[model samples]
Target: MRSITSRRNVIMKAIVVFIITGLLTIPGYTLAGTSNISSNGTPHHPAFVESRDDLVNVQVAHRSSPSHPMAPNTADVNIIELLQQLNEPLILGYLENLTSFGPRETGTPSCDQAAHYIFDTFQNMGLVVRYHNYTDATVSGSNVEATLYGNDTTNIFIICGHYDSVAAGPGADDDGSGVAAVLAAAEIMRNYDFDHTVRFVAFSGEEQGLIGSYHYVQDAYNSNESIVAVLNADMIGFTATGSDGIVGKIFENPASEWIVSFTQDISVIYSDYIGIQLFPQGETWGSDHYYFWEYGYDAVFYHEYHFNDYYHSANDTIDRMNITYSTRFSRLILATLAQMAQQPVQQRPVLEISSISGGLGVTAQINNIGDANASDVKATILITGGLFNLINVQSTSEQTVLNAQGSMQSKAMVFRLGKILITVAADASNADQVTKQATGFLLGPFVLEVVIAP
Candidate 1:
């Protein structure tokens, strides 16, 4: 184990980093490797990938690997440690304070009180806080946003939950659980250093069909703000049955599956001691994430798996919630947000294409060129024959995950005659794809270069 010292000198929270050893296998899907070619070689690619679900499940081992599958890197471990700073008493206290304001209904004084409390809490954590006010025919309210700036100010990740609840009594479980989780995550992560900006947002008017989120996204989109991802927690305190019952649902869209899967992986690796289940399901409507998804950004939802019988009633108090379970959600979600915001100290992988014979094929070289490991790397080739006939081929002859300065080469497909140019596209993990092109004018071992900067 290594000692961690925050650059900001925010008192580091002591925590035990658990090293988990287990694998969850997906039932049906498997990555079937093959020679991937034909005699008159044109890459056999089923357009549109059939379904994104077939790609990968970060939680479960879609296939067996000799190395520790989905192992946590330094940043991941550090983020988990930071998330472990979440305490049940702290979250319970926030819940108590929030519920004390009574039902935070839109257009009500209670709603204003709740927003101010969230703003004050964020300010006390040394975060940049603001209130987004909007008005509609039926009601008007505010969305509170707090930002913990990272090295990169352009890329923003959000952890948002609604504070205003339905006209239902005190609205504790309806949204207080979610607000607590968001506040707790923000508090725990405040002292840490991140490479990407993270926003702790408390949305109002969610009960009125996600009004606050809608306005926020609309404003953000119009301003050309880049929202990398949104993780929304709602009603995570209540269990379906008794104290023994421990399960919650992680809902997501195709674009958001990666976030959901990454979160599920954290639940397994870092905090299984919570003895709770994270059931990932659905691609439909609900929560603040819904509006983000509607606007074509990546987003996910976290909620109690089973509907609470006492939800929206006066009986829905702190006593009715399983505080331990609620604490688990805060910890789990905080870890996810922390890990996503923590960019490891690594440069992006660079691609170089060498030994292009003009007619047959080309050797594509991919170098990690970074301190941290880069996984799930892929190199794709495209060639243009006569009169704009485009051909696609798999450039990577082998798997492309690379260590620091590690390099791997692949012999791409042998294109037919009259090929004008060969283009290679390379992407690793969460990094975007970069392309390099070579024209057939090459006479010697063709050298192609592509550099992806961090």
Candidate 2:
């Protein structure tokens, strides 16, 4: 393994050169092979690119511009609620647990255990979970994914962090902070609905020259997934005492400039809530978000402006981190995601079944929460399964028109003996259908022990 001190010295020298020259150039690449040299023959940042073979066989993928353009908008009141839901204790707990696993180097038992822990946590959140396995000559590991499917499944938004740490330390601030942020976002955002799918990913083998992210991006490109944007958090926990204030540095490439602008807008609109300022920086390929750029996908890297001296060392632990600062960064990311996946701005009916109750019969409340009035609003209730399959009742609401924010109660539908499953649906001419299901036991019009499905 290369010496960490040497890498740090190289980075410091690069920074000095950049400062002295005041001339920043993009990293040069060849269509035939992988190289980090620029047109002037100067190598790019050595801290990020470990070896030339990391980029082998990686053809530059082409993609058209995004269909859903990002626009500057004020923070939504509902998104504020999501921001408030980011719990500091939960974030701390995740970080502490991750650091307890010791050095999680790729292909080691500790790294495998960390992967399973992340996978299990995502599974417990009731998300669609899976393991993306990859193998190369030097290392092999899996990337854990937890997906919250949206109304439009094709469009995707990703928030990711590397789970494997260096062999020297637990990597609490280096990346454990980032993994905690992703977990916290997933835990809270799963309860709400969005127009675009959100994926929480924890990658392994990142220390081995971005191996995990490279394979994952390759597969995503081959499958033709329409990835909208990616938010990658690497180190966001430390803030030195007597510093000016918490400042986040967001790094982006030319293709992802719009994402940085959108993030800046979000930071401003939510400044009162997050209390953290942002600085947009030029391209840097030191983190996992770099491969997305190679595949023609837009991505940004979120990093701390104040550098931590304990990075990649044995002293990088929870005691050195600031939980409040980390939680605030998570809030900023959650707010950005909420706005990016927001519903269309057009005025249309959004029908929902607010509630369903049973006493002498089953009744459901249909609500129109959209801005426009809904015409031809209809509701349906169907009950199936009971003793001898003899108790089945189906009913529909009377034809009606509902104004914006208007709600109507469905007529009671009575059913007889045995355990049953009830499915209620509501729809409008301008809105898509919404359905709710429940399981209950009915003893002659007295529905008992009803449980609703999520």
Candidate 3:
């Protein structure tokens, strides 16, 4: 008994609903307000629009983002001296040998030859060497892993670089520098013992969209491995004209920022030995680190700040590369890995507030009484119990490191006029915290009298 007009309205509403539902289900169809737009005002298609596999890969890449530990403020003497063993000539020799295999394109005989050379070198270093074989629809190759197993086998750290080149060139600068660095690191680090296992890996098929790395990471994930951190080096030997040979760039994603910060600390602590400075940059997807990020592991990519014009071409050879730069970069990475993999039975640092005084400000002397070095030490000064209990101020000192039996002074300027209870405390990573207290009369940037609390 419905009216003709009402019937017509109902049909029209159903039509509209059906049209919208159909549009929502279509691939590449985005709502008007929700469409992703590029910086140039063009409508950017979502990854799924081109291929559903791309969307799946992106989702997998964001599966897990782990945080890394804070960096230390000081370097170990043993590590510093060990770094002296890495020289320009040593790295150049490795690079020359790698490139001698010719262009190591994946699935080619040259690539197989290069893999064999790396495996043999690792075996010669007396490390636990193995070939991680992987086969996909496009490429099949073996990833070489040389492991220095730590006392704690559950925790693992990896330093890696690709060894494959494009079809056109030997790929010396593109990755030979990185491979050379890894081999040099393995040669030196094999003699030391660490708390966590360290892996030196050379992957192939990197030029073909990270095939080897992707396969390796996927398997590691499937086996439920606990990988602490990954440091990846690619194309780290080029120094352009007018560019400072000492400065290198480290690229990292948000999850791997701690690793970048840690590398920065290593650069500062070993600046004299490495002779290389580091600057942190945002994430890049062109290296093996991309696969680690995709599987939720924290990783950082080390590369030259100056791009190589000869990348992926026949011109990427030894003469065009800087061996000194490569050696320095390799030294920095080696120092970082050595620290992250703590030495077995190493003594922990002990921090103590040796003395507290007030003059132009409140000053506290912090000392490392333990046999080990104290890093990222911080001293804090607190003032309270002034006139009418109106004073409650606090100040902290800049973070620093104290070698065994070494001491540093931390001061906080005060501008109050009254009697105050002063509490001074100092702490550091891997060290015991210490505190001291005293009653002082402050007179405009100076303490007239202080009574030490027993």
Candidate 4:
């Protein structure tokens, strides 16, 4: 009986060792079939993380680009012309409107007067204006909203600034700057007929924690309003002036990269001649834009990087303001709005396989459904798991074919066709890019098979 028991124990030990060996070999077996295989033919752990700081959770929606190919009407909206228009009368007029009382805090009589001034300005421009008013005790204020309808009323872009000045400070740079920019943009685009709608808002109670913006966003959401992006122009009046004073600042948000890119493109085109410096700040807390961003709305904060010292004190008056900076900033905002208003919709890519018989050469086509063209678009193939290693695919305006190296960033390759995967990956952008991956494999080899055999 003792001998039999010893033999059983040895067999059990062998079984456990075999189980451990199989478990250890499982990942290798699985990756061998997929594109996760290394150049040495060994399976590699696919680098797929749940979250990445730079990764954008982009939705392939049929939306239009904010860039319209149309030309601008006014050729001479230069610094001289812009500054001439934003003269002392206009600057002081706006400041007076802002500082009619000490601390035009929300819900105060001063707040109401500020709203009236903004509303009157919009009305005087001969454009339709609407106000979305709500009472909030936090800032103890009321909100003002104005909308200029376009050819397409279904889609709208929003521009907002806080009008209610702070209590201890005049809040000129804090928001009076933003309010002025909003008015300037409104006046410029008043007579223009756009393809998309625009809403110019002067928010109150921002010092009290974005109360007005919260109310506005809540109302829009409740009404099922379709707003694509919210461009918050706050505190752009004062900038670092000198020889290199042309700096364009935008606060960064992971969910709003597209908006930031769009603004950057416009700033590059419109302000580069002035030596424009485009800055993307990742951390900015105070402003009305935060409320819209909180609601998952694509929001971008436009400002000048180094604001002047006269921000929020008794000295935060209009005389110290930089009308040149304000004019340039306003013009940029107007240009962006005008361009986006007439943009064609963007299309998602559609992949179609044409011929796969050329051994390593796979040819296909990519169709763009959106009106906007993906000029630099490329393609890459990843083997689910097989002997065929996906190198790189290049896209042309007409076709996308697999290349030996698989460089996805090849500008020569336009992705009018579907991507072809072969021995190499087409570009570095897709080299580490993952389409799908498993977290952990505990059981056996994960095999991804690429069947080239007909």
List model 2 lDDT by residue over 1-454, tens digit each: 7699999999999997775333112211111221252211112222335655545455552354344445657768888888888978999999988988999998999999999999999999999999999998768999999999989888888999999888999999879988999999999999999988999999888877788998999999988888888998888888887352468788887667767887788888988878888888777777889899888788988887787778878988999988889898888887877788774534566677888887877888988887778889878777777666655567778456898899998854554566888888777665555678888887765778888776
lDDT of each: 0.66, 0.79, 0.78, 0.55
Can you list the residue pairs that collide in candidate 2?
A: none
User: Rank by lDDT, descending?
Assistant: 2, 3, 1, 4
TM-score against native, each model: 0.61, 0.65, 0.65, 0.60
Per-residue alpha-carbon lDDT of model 1 for 157-214, expressed as tens digits? 8998889876668878778998998998888888888888899999887776677887
**CA deviation > 4 Å runs, candidate 4:** 1-88, 134-137, 221-224, 254-277, 343-454
Worst 10 residues of 1 by lDDT: 60-69
lDDT of 3 by residue, 1-454 (tens): 9999999999999997786455333332111121232211111111112322442274332232222444676678888877999998889999999999989998899999999999999999999999999997778998999999998897788999999888889989889999998999999999888888899999987876678888899899888787888999898898986455889888887657678878888888888988788887776676789778877788888988788888878999999988888899999999888888883333556677777787776777877777777789877777775545555667777466689889888776655566889887776765545668888986655775777676
Candidate scoring better on lDDT of 1 and 4 = 1
Better of 3 and 4 by TM-score: 3
Q: Which ten residues in a row have the lowest lDDT in candidate 4?
A: 38-47
How well is each residue in 163-214 modelled by candidate 4, as lDDT tens digits? Answer: 8765666767667877877777677567567778888888876666666787
The model with the greater TM-score, 2 or 4, is 2
